[model samples]
Target chain A: MGEESKKELTLSVSAPSGTSKEDHASRRTFIKNLAIAGAVIGTNALVAKKVASVVLEKDPQRAYLEDVLPGDRVMMAREYVVMTDEEKKRLVKTLIENYKKRLG
Target chain B: MKREDKKTTIEKNIEGSTRRDFLKKTGSLSVAGLAGVATLMTGTKDAQARVTWAEWFQTNYRLMTEEEKREAIERLEKRYSEEYGKKVTVDGRPAQKNVLFGYALNIQKCIGCRRCVKACVKENNQSRHDPEIEWIRVIRMEKGKFSAEDMDKGYPSDYGIQVGGNAYKNAGVVLEGQHYYQPERVPEKDAFYFPIQCMQCEKPPCVKVCPVRTTYREPDGIVVIDYNWCIGCRMCMGACPYWARRFNWGEPNLPKEEMNPDTHYLGNRPRMKGVVEKCTFCLQRTRKGRYTACVEVCPVGARKFGNLLDPESEVRRILERKRVFRLRVDLNTFPKFFYFID
Candidate 1:
C-alpha cells in the first residue's frame, strides 16, 4: 500500500471515536482489502528477491572439511539401520584391529 | 532527808565509775562495731536473695550485652558440668570458627521409617517430655500427592468402641480409610517421605521476622536463634512454611543425665521458657567438622551433605548432576536444603 493510505488506515482503525456504524464499516473494509492485496504481491516479491539472492550466494557446505579442527573426528560411514551377523563380526574385527594398531 | 541524800550520793559515785568505763571502751567500739553491723547485714541480704542476672532482669537472649552473655554462658556451663558429671560447655564458640556443615536427602528412598525422627531427638538434646520440640519430623505422603492438606485428612482416627462392658479389637464400627502407624509397612503404594526441618535458608525468614534480630543466618548458612534474645513473639514460628520452629512453653524438661554436653553457640544449648528454637543442622556436632547425627544414621545412604561453595563438595556435585528441587520455589526464600526424588 502507499505510505499515506497505510498511515490513514492505521489511524482510522485505532481512533477511539471510530465506533460509529459508518466509521467501523469503512475501517473494516479498508483493512480487508489491504490484507488481500498485500498478501498476493508481498509473497511473490519476497520469493523473487530471495531466489535472486540464493543464485548470487556462495555454497557453505563445500568448505565443511576445511572448517573442521585438527583434533576433530568426522563420521565418514553411513549409519547402518539393519546389519547382518557377518557385517557385525566384520565391524568388530576392524575396531579391534584399529585399537591394537593404535596401542602398539 | 539525810538518808536519801546519802543513797543518791552513792548512786552518783557508781554512775561516775560506769561512765568512766564506757568512755574508755568507746574509742575501741565506735568504728569497729558500726563496720561489723553493716558487713553482717549486707552478707545476710546477699545470701538470702541469690537471683541470677537473667532472672533479675527477665532478659531473653536479645537483651544481653556481650559481657552479660559471656557471664551467663559461663554460669550455665559451670552449673551444667556440675550436674551432668562432665566438663559441659553449654555454649561453644560461634560455628564460623573452623566449623562447617551441609545436609541432603533422597526423598524417593525414605520409607517413612520415622527412625530418623527418634534419632534426631536423642542427638539434638530435645526434651523427652515433648519429643516434638526438636530437630526433625518425617512427613509420610503418597507420590504426586505430597501436599499438607492431604496428609492432614489422611491421619488415622480412633473411635473407642465398647462391647460387653469392655472394648474388644474390631468390635465397634470400623472407620473406613483409617490407617495406624506401623514401623515396617510403608504408608502408601507410591509412598514418598519428606523429612522436614530447618532449611538453613540462605535468606532465612525466621531471621528476618525476629523483631529483636535475635535470630540470624551465620556465614556458613546455618540459622541460629538466641534463646535469651527471643521475646517469645512466635513470629519466626509463623514465618516458617515447613513448621520447623517450636516455642519453649516451659523450661525444657530434659533429664540432667541425657542432655548433650558438646553444645555449639548456635546449637542445642538449653533454652529457657518463652523463646523459639529449631534445628541448627546439628551445628553443635556438625559445625565442629563432624557429620549430622541424622546423616550418619541413615541406613539407606539417602542423606548427603557437603559444602555447596566448594566445587568438589558432594552437595555441589549433586546440584550439578541431579534434578534437585526445594520445597516452595515460588517463595524465593533460597533454601540451602534440597530434595532429590532419585
Candidate 2:
C-alpha cells in the first residue's frame, strides 16, 4: 500500500474513543489492522518502535501514574512508568498479608 | 508517608517470605520481564556490560550477597569508566561501624554566598542542561518575617520591590526556579540564608516510598540511591517534603574538562535521563574520612559535619553546646541536618 493509504488505514482503524459493544468490535478490528501495519513497517525496527511508542503511551495501564499523580510535573513522566500510591500500597499490603499468613 | 514508629512496615513486611517468594511478593517477577525487555531494547549492552537481564534483576543492596555486591560495584565502575573515558571508582563503602553522620549549619555565620550549592553541582555530577539540576537550594529569607510565599518574589523585605514589573533601578533579584542566584553579594543586611538539601532523615520518607527499594539508609545513617536500579519513577520525589530529589529530564551534560572523576556507586556517578538523584553527604569523600563538598567549600566555615556518635566530634559538640533546631520538627523525620547559631 502507498504511504498515504497506510496513514489513512491507521486513523480509520484506531482504538475506539469510548466503551460500547460497537467500540469493542472496532477495537478488535483496529488491533488486526495494527498487526498488518507493524508487519509492513517492521522492516525498519526504529520507525516501527517510534510509531509503537506513540500507541503504547495511549494505553490505559500506562496512564495510571500520569492521571492521579499530584505534582507540578504532570504528564512529564508519561514516557516513564511509575507505580502509583494506590498500586504500591495495594501490592505491598497484599504481599505482606500473604507473607504473614504463610508464616503463621 | 510511613511513620517511623510503624512496626512491620513495607520495608520489613516480607520477612516471612523466602527470597524467591519475596521476589514474587514485591511483584518484581511480573515487572522483571518488562524491565528486561526495556533494558534490551533501549540500552542493550550499554557501556560494555551495563544493560543485561542479570543486572536488571539484581536484588537490592541490603539483600544482596557479598559476591553480588562486589559484582554490582564492578559493573558500575566499568560502565562509568567507559562513559567518562577515565578510571572511575564506584565504591560500595558501608557506613563506619560506630559512626552516625550528622550536620549542623551555623545560620549566623552563613553569608548566603551559595558557595556550597555550586560545589555540590560539580561534586554530585548534576545535570547542567535545559532543566538544570542541583540538589541544594539556598533560601534567602528576612530575619524575622519568614513566610515561604516571599521566596517567589526574591525581593528585599522592606523595599517591596516588585521584580520584572516595577521600574526600580535594581528590581529585586532574578531567581531561577526559586533558587537565589548571582545577587553580587549575599546576606543582604536584613536577610538570613537557609541552604537545604537531603536531611538524611533517620526515617526518610523517600526511602519508604520507593517501590523498587532503590533508595535506602546506610548503617552509618546516610540516605543514598542506586542509580542503576532506580526505575526513573518519581515517587520518592513526591514523598520528599523537602523536595530534595532531582530527576534528569534529559541526558546529563557534563563537560569532560569539568567532570569530577571521584565517584561512588550510590553518589556521584554520571546519571542518564529519568533516574532520581539527591545528596548523599558526598559518600565518595565521607567514606575516606574527608568532609563533604559543601563543608569543604563554605567560605565562612558555617557548615559542620562529623560522626554524631563521637562525643568529641564537632557535630556532637555543636549539638551539646550550640542552640540548634531542625526543619519540620512536627513531622518527626528526626533529620540529621541541624540549623545552629554560634
Candidate 3:
C-alpha cells in the first residue's frame, strides 16, 4: 500500500507532456528548498520571540520603557541641580536680552 | 437528557432533601468558600491577590482614621517595595498648622530652560512614557507688536469678533503661545517664557466640578486629590482654567529604577489608571519643611515657594515687594500661585 501511494505521489509530480525532465527536476528541487527555508525562518522567529519574553520577564519595566520616544525620555537628560553662580549669571543675561528686545 | 426526565430528577432531589440536610450542605459550602478566600488572602505575596483587594475597599485618604491610614500606608509600602525592588515609603503627613503654602514664579527671570518641568516629572513620579506627564508647562510667547495698522484693523474696520489684535499685528503678548519649541539654547531671541501649574486655588474650579468630592483644599491651603476615590470623570480637567489637571488615560508607565521611593500619598505616589492627578505643591516634602522640586531645580531662582502666612517667607516677600499678579484674576479662582517680575 505504501509503495502504491508513493507511485501516486510520483505520478502527481510528473511534468506535463511538453515539459522537459531537467526543468521538472529543477522545479521539484526549488519547491522543496522553498519549504525548508520557510520552516527555518518560522522557527527562528519563534525562538527570537521566546528570548525577548525571557528578557522582558527578567526586567518587566524594560517592555514599558521600550516604547518611549527618545525626546520624551527625561531620565536620559542631565538631571537639574541647584544653579551655580556662573549658570545663574548666564541665564540672567539671556533673560535681559529677551526682555530688552520686547521692551524696544 | 429529555426535558421530562430532567424535571423529574430535579423534583426528586428537591423533595428528598430534608431541612437539616439542606442547611448542612449550604453551611459546608460556605465554609469551603471562606477557606478558599482566606487562603488566597494569606497564602500569596502577590500584590493583586492581597494589597489591591484591600486598596479597592479602603476609605479616602481624607476620611481614613489614623490607624486606618497607617495600615493603608503600610500596605502601599509593602506592595511598592516588592514591585520596585527597594524600600518605598508613602508619606501620610498631615498639613502643618498655620502654614498656608504659596508659590511665586519670576516670569522675567525664567529662561525657558524647562529644568523645572523635568524636575517636577522626576520628583512627582509622573508617568515616564506613552503619556509623558509633567505638571509644569512652559509657554514661549513672541513679543507682540503694537503697530498703528493693527490698531485700526481690529476695531469696526473689520467685520470679525472685534478682539483686540488684528490680522496685521498683536497689541501685547498675544494669546498665541508655542508650547513645544525646541531651541539650541533657551531665552531664544525675542521670546519670553510663562510657566504654569496648579494654582492651589482658594476656590479651585477643579474641586467644585469633581462629582466624587475626591479633590479638596487641605487646611494648609494645598489642593489635593484622593486618587483612589477619583472616578476619572475628567470634569476637573475641563473646569480648571490653568489646564492643571491630568487624567491617567492608561495605566501609568512608571519604571522601577526611575521611581522616586519617597512619595506623599496625595502628591507623587505612583498612580494607577482611571485617576486624576495634579500638582499638590509637593505636600510630601512641603509638609516636612522642604521646597517643592520645581523651586529647588529652577536655574535662575525663578521659582519660589513658602508658607504664605509667614511675613519672612519668600512667597510673601515677593507679594509685598515685586510686581506680582495671579493669572485669570477676573475668573475669581483666587489662586495661591502668583507670577512676579524682579
Candidate 4:
C-alpha cells in the first residue's frame, strides 16, 4: 500500500471499535496538538499545569489564594510568565474579564 | 608560518598588502565602526543613567555614615531623575527621636472601599501598569468566627469559611475570609473587612528573618526596608505573618508622570526589580509628621495614625478606649496596627 493508505490503516486500527471516520480524524488532530503543546513548553509539567491554571482561571486573584476561592480573585500583572500562543489567547480573555470587574 | 609572524610580515610589506588582506582589514574595520555607531545611537542620554560601583556597593541605611548617605542620596536622585526624565528628590529623612508610629482601624467603619489601597500605590512608588503590586490586602470575612488560630487549622475555616455552611445558601455560593474580596459595594451585608499591611510590628518577624538585614525596624518603631541592599531572597516575605511584603518577579514599570517625585531613602524611593517592598507607614510622609496616605485618604475616618509615644495622641487614646485587637496576637508580634470597634 502507498504511504497515505498505510497511515489510514494505522489510524483505523488505533481507533476504538465502531468509531466513525470523523471521530478518528478528530482524535488524530487532538493528539497531534497535544504533542506540539508538550514540545513547545520550556518548563516542567508542574509549572505548565500552573501556567494552564493561570490561563483558564482568574479569580480570587493569585495562585497562592489560600483565602480567596479558586474563581473570585483577579489576576495580578506581576504573575505573568512566558506562554504559548494558545495560552496567551486565554490569558488575554481572562485579563479583559478581570479588567471589567476592576479587581484591586 | 606562525600566524603572528605572517601578520607582522604583511604589516611591514613595503609593496602594500594583497586584495585578500585589504578586504579582511576593511571588513573588520567597518564592523567595528558599525558597532561604535550603534552604541552611540542607542545610548541613554543621561550620562549617570547607569548604576555606579559606589551606588552598587553603598553601605546599608543603618550603617551609612552622614557623608556616605549624602553621596548615596545624590546618586539615587540623579539616576532616578534620568530614568524618569524629571527632577526627583531622594531624601534620607530620619525618624524623630520623640516619635513612635502607631496605626488603628475602626473595622466597622471601613466600608472595604479599598481607597487606601489606591492611595498607597500612588504615594509609595509601588509598581504599576505591569505586574501590579499592592502593599495592603483587605480580607473580607463572613460574620463568623475567624482568627490566626483558625487559619492554622487549614481549609475553608482557615480562610474563614465555616464548614457545613448555611444549608439554604446556594451551592458554590459560600465565599469568605479570602485576601482578595471584590464585592460590588464593600461592607456586604453579612460580611466585614480586614485591611492588612505591614503592621510596623514592634518585634517584626519579617525583620528577624532577613539574612541580609535589609529590613529593620526604625528607632521610631516603623519597620522599613533598604531596597538597594535587599538580595531578593524572599526570606522576609516568608516570615511576615501578615503577608505584607511583595516581590518583583519581573522588571516593574512605572510611568514618568506617575512616579512619585518625593521619596525617602528607606521608604517610597523607586525600587528596582527583585527587591522586597512593604508599607513603611509612607516613610516619605510619615517621618515628616504627616499621616500615611491610607489614613489621609480614608473618607470614613476609619483609619487613624499617630505617635504611640504621645499620651494624648489619637492612637494612644484609641488603645486606651476602644475594644481593639491585633491579628495573630498570640504570636506576640506586638504589631502597631490594630483593628478596633467603637
Candidate 2 chain B: minimum summed lDDT over ten consecutive residues — where? B165-174
Best by lDDT: 3
Candidate 2 colliding pairs: none
Q: Second chain TM-score per prediction?
A: 0.69, 0.76, 0.82, 0.78
Error of 2 at B294 (Å): 0.6
TM-score of 1: 0.55
Best by DockQ: 2
Instruction: Give candidate 4 misplaced runs (Cα > 4 Å).
Output: A1-104, B1-50, B145-180
lDDT of each: 0.60, 0.69, 0.73, 0.71
Better of 1 and 2 by lDDT: 2
Best by TM-score: 3
User: Measured against the native two-chain assembly using Cα atoms, what DockQ does each of the candidate structures obtain, in the order listed?
Assistant: 0.00, 0.02, 0.01, 0.01
Q: List candidate 3 segments past 4 Å from native.
A: A1-104, B1-45, B145-177
Q: What is the C-alpha RMSD of each candidate to the true structure, in Å?
A: 37.8, 21.3, 19.4, 21.1
Q: Give TM-score values for chain A, per-prediction.
A: 0.28, 0.23, 0.39, 0.23
Candidate 1 chain B minimal-lDDT segment of 10 residues: B166-175
Which pairs clash (backbone N, Cα, C closer than 3 Å) in model 1?
A: B60-B228, B60-B229, B61-B228, B61-B229, B62-B229
Instruction: Name the regions of candidate 2 deviating beyond 4 angstroms.
Output: A1-104, B1-54, B145-178
In terms of TM-score, how similar is model 2 to the real structure?
0.63
